[model samples]
Target: MIRLLLVDDQELFLQGLAMILESQEGLEVVGTALDGEQAIARTRELQPDVVLMDIRMPVLDGVSATAAIRRESPEPPPHVIVLTTIRHDEAVVDALRAGASGFLLKDARPEFLVQSIRAVVEGQQVIAPAETFDLLRAFAPVRPAPDASILAELTERERELFALAARGLSNADIARQLWVAETTVKTHMRAILTKLGVASRVQLIALAYEHRLIEV
Candidate 1:
């Protein structure tokens, strides 16, 4: 079963969302929190498999709470998907930088949200690639003297896959573009992540932008 924790300041939304998710098979609503501080506390207590976190909240915010959860959690730490109202908000980027698995719009279809939770558990990012690419372009700053030597750690094929993934392409998309199996792309991605020491593609994108490696 995929254990989940929901975090949002709005009580009504939390109740409604939890109802929808709890109805689905293989899912369990383990807890809910009204603020980031509560999120941290509940997460430590429950140790859920996933957390649906709202980016804006009182007493704390999702980004800070995500950082704390990821930093202190045990092995196979919970996957955090940040929820937001704005598509191009910089806080989403910050959340991703702070170790969120990805961002999801609050108005997404229930089925899509449900699929995202499952996909996230399967090591797939739950986000819109094109929009996320645009978001990175807008908020990711370019250094005057960028250092991307860490990219050298990747093998040639891994570097190619990294470039496509940094541009927000999915593993399946990369597989189609590279004329390989999706599982093959997934393998390369795992190797790339381990080589560069990034936890997810979001962090990989952040690292690429930090080093000005990807052309904006």
Candidate 2:
């Protein structure tokens, strides 16, 4: 079962989300927190597989909390997905930079939310398709061009896969597109992450955009 922690200041939202998630098979709501500080504490105590975190909260915000969790947690840290109400908020980028696996709008369908939880746990980044372009565009102006030497390290095939990932394709999608096994796509993705010195696929996307590897 995928263990989960829900963090949000709104009591109703948090409880409702917990109820919905618990109703799904293969998922367990291990705990819930009202803010980032509690989220961090619960993460250490419960060691959940995933955290559904709200971007804005009292005590500490999701981005900083994500950074702390990623930096301080032991091996196999919980994957974090920032929950936000806005579609194109810059905080999503900040949260990703801080090691969040991805972002999801608060209004996402229940089924998509469940699917995203499973997807992230399986090593896929999960930004909503509609928000992908806008999120990338929001980061374009401020990001420095990606390091050319780092970009040069990718093999031709790796570059192709990287471009696909930057375009918001999941590992399964990339595998199907290239007629390769999903494991092969994952292997390439791991190599890409290491070569680019990035922690997540979201960062890879940002780098791709900054370097013009793929059109926005």
Candidate 3:
């Protein structure tokens, strides 16, 4: 089962999410917190598989809480999906920099929310398309050129794959674009991850921007 903990200041929204997710098989709502501090406490106590953390809260904010949670080594920090009303807000960037696995807008559909949770828990990252462009542009001016030395390690095919990845293409999308099977794309993705030393595509995009591998 995919155990989940919700941290939101809005009771109605929290209850609504719990209600929507409870009926789904293999998905469980293990706990709820009205603020970031409680969320951290519940995390230490419940040890959930995923956390839906609100970016703004009373006692502490999600960014600081995510940083705190990540600092606890060997305890296995839950993958966090920061919930925000604004798309690509500076707070969202701060949360990601602090090690959040993903971000979801509060207005996102229930299905999308579920998908975000599943993706993050399974070691994938998801950011809204608009948010991605915003993030890329944040580092555009001062970003260094793509490290050709590091990229030279890539095979020709891997080079193409890396470029598609930097453009935020999904494995399936890259497969279609490259006329390869999805499983083949997965293999290339693993290679890309190893070559880039990135945990997820969000980080990959950030690195690509930082290295000027992709244009703004």
Candidate 4:
């Protein structure tokens, strides 16, 4: 089963979402938290595989809570998918910077939410709402770049794949653009992630911007 911990300050919405998710096969709502502080505590106690986190909450906000969970959890920390109303792009970017696996709109369809959770657990990346690439222009934390040297460890094909992925293309999209198998794209992606020392494609995209590899 895919264990989940839902965190939101809104009690009613939280309960409703849990009911919807629990009805789906393969997902179990292991616990719920009303604020970020409780989220951190429940995460340690319940050990859920994924955290559906609310970006804004009392006591502590989701972004700060995400960073704390990543820092404090033992190896292989639970993946975090932050919930957002999305009026503030900066907060979403901050959540990604804090190690959230992705962000999902608070009103996202139930099917999409389930897909995102499965994708993260299976070692895939999730960026949502289709235009998220342009939205995440938050300053990249890095020095001036050759772009080439920062990505020196990558092969030419990997570099190409990296650029495509950094632009928010899904693996299937990248494969179609390159005329390769989707599995081939996934293989290169794994190599790129390993060589770059990043955990997810969201982090890969962050690094690309930080190093000025992709022109803003």
Which predicted model would earn the best TM-score? 1
Candidate 3 contains a number of clashing pairs equal to 0
Candidate numbers, best TM-score first, in rank order? 1, 2, 4, 3
Candidate 3 TM-score, C-alpha based: 0.82
Off by over 4 Å in 3: 71-77, 138-141, 144-159, 194-197
Candidate 1 per-residue lDDT, tens place, 1-216, comes to 999999999999999999999999999999999999999999999999999999999999999999999989998789999999998999988898888888899999999999999999999888866777788888976677778698877788998998899888888889999999999998999899889876778788878877888775
The stretch of ten residues in a row with the least summed lDDT in candidate 4 is: 129-138
Please give the lDDT score for candidate 4.
0.86
Quote each prediction's TM-score: 0.92, 0.90, 0.82, 0.86
**Candidates, ranked, lDDT:** 1, 2, 4, 3
Task: Work out how many backbone clashes candidate 2 has.
Answer: 0
Q: Tens digits of per-residue lDDT for model 2 on 170-190?
A: 888999999999999999999
lDDT of each: 0.90, 0.86, 0.79, 0.86
The better-scoring model by lDDT among 1 and 4 is: 1
- Candidates 2 and 4 compared: the better one by lDDT is 2
On residues 1-216, what C-alpha lDDT tens digit does candidate 4 reach at each position?
Answer: 999999999999999999999999999999999999999999999999999999989999999999999879888889999899874567877888788888888988999989999999987776652445565554445556545676889999999999999888889999999999999999999999889887678887877877777765
Residue 103, model 3, lDDT: 84
In angstroms, the error of model 1 at 57 is 1.0
lDDT of 2 at 147: 47
Show model 1 residue runs off by greater than 4 Å. none
lDDT comparing candidate 2 with the true structure: 0.86
